[model samples]
Structures are given as C-alpha cells and as structure tokens.
Target: MNAPTMKTELMDAIKYDEPFRAHAIYYAIQQGYVQIDDPYNGLPADMDYDAIKKMQHANILQMCTVKIFTIPFGQGMHAIYLANCENDARAKHFTLYRQHAQRIQNASRRMDVSLYCEETGTHEVIRETKRRAAEFPWYVGVVGW
Candidate 1:
C-alpha cells in the first residue's frame, strides 16, 4: 500500500497493544520526541513566569513518534495480499510482497501517541511530599517529561 495507508495500519496495530503503547509513549516523552507549545510565547503580560512554566510542564507529557520504512514490491501488489506468519508478521508480509521488484516502490509511515497518565505511580511519593508541603489537596505536577 501507499505510505500513508501503511503508516496508519502499523500505528493502529501498535495501538492495539496497550502496554507497548504506554512504554513507547513514556520513552518518547523522556526523550523529548514530541514538542509542546511554548506557553510563555504568547501569554498576556500579566501572566507570571511560574504560571507559564506550569502550563508548559503540564502539557510536556504528551508524546508522539513517527517511523518510516521503504518497501519495494511489484506493481499492483499490496501487503494485504501476503499471508501473515506467526514470526514477525508485518516483516514477513513486506518481504513476500517485495520480491525482486524494481519499478514499484512504496514507503510506510507510522505515528505512535501517548497521553499523560496521572496514576502511573512513578512519582507518587514525591508528589505526595509536595502536596503535604502545600497543606491542601494537591499532588506535585509532572516535572520531567
């Protein structure tokens, strides 16, 4: 198939597996694979630095990653035509479809996404400590992406 279609299929497959998706998302965020809007850039003059920083960090947990691959197959042959194998199903399909073909070429792109999860438990202790300091019902916000 075409690049866009292939990407969607691959990303959808990844999304079908929740654990993998979560890991990918966390990894992407830690690596800064996604970019968040600069809250301070267009903020009103009255807004202070702390508010801008909080806004920026609040959205930094969002993550996205794109993977692209090139496949060479015969004209009119698509990946769906290939049989799915137990081992490396997607790779098997690609290899079968792209056999000694020179003219027809295609590329696949996949984007993976992950949203923030407050109950991740990684920073609960620190969050609780900060909340205690505030002497109110609050949790420390996510600090590092």
Candidate 2:
C-alpha cells in the first residue's frame, strides 16, 4: 500500500484509540516513532518522556509492522500484539557499541558516531541513509531495493 493510505489508516487507528495497533502501523511506515504506552501490550501505566527516551536510546522504539494482531473489546478496550524484529548479531553489535560510546564521563568530550557510519562529509549519503532508515529500515527487509 502507498504511504498516504497507510498514514491515514494509522491516524484513524489512533483517533479511534486503538493504541497498540496504531503504533504498529506507524512503525511499519514511520521508523523511529511509536506511541508511549499500549495497554494491550502490558506497558507501564506511568510511561513518560524519560521512559520513552530510554526506549529510543536503546533503539527499541519501533513497533512490529511485519505482523500484528488485535482483539477489540466492545467498549473500546483492546489487546494488541505488535511483533518487533528479533535482535540479530548486527543489532547487538551496534547496541553494545552505542552503549560503550555513551559511557564517557566527560560531558563535552564524547565523539558522535552513527551506527551506519555516515559520519563524514557526504550530505547525500546522510540524506539517503536517513530516508531509508525512516521510510524503509533495513531491519524490516525493505531497504536496498
């Protein structure tokens, strides 16, 4: 399906308060973004910015778009399954590397490095990577076409 249709469907899901399913569609389409708490998934009730940021930093923010299941209750209650990708060797490597980099005690002395290593003078590469990362992340098996 096209992006516009997908986006509309996502918005509709959220507007209807179908929380988890909404996020699943969003992550399936928009990478690096997700709803804060999905009751169907058993997330903490007190989710806040700090919690969300923690998830983002750990790269665990995206929902599972490849597969999803939802059970709707007549009174707007629902159970949802947003199945995210399983961690593989590459993801583990990057996660560890990011953790090691973030451990520097000096506040201003940390060097910035991206997992995909587009750290230098190539604006085009950066832009392309950003596009792919957001529109079709490699982990989703949608990139490199």
Candidate that scores best on lDDT: 2
Estimate, for each residue in 5-89, the C-alpha lDDT of model 1 and write its tens digit: 3234324434443333333333333444432222212212343445334534453333222112223333533222111122232
Give the per-residue lDDT digits (tens) of candidate 2, residues 1-145.
4334555665665544444545455444444333423222323344354544554445453322322222232254322222223233234324433421211111111111122333453433222332344332132111111
Candidates in order have lDDT scores of 0.31, 0.34
Q: Which ten residues in a row have the lowest lDDT in candidate 2?
A: 102-111
Candidate 1 clash pair list: 7-109
RMSD of 2: 18.5
Ten contiguous residues with the weakest lDDT in model 1: 104-113
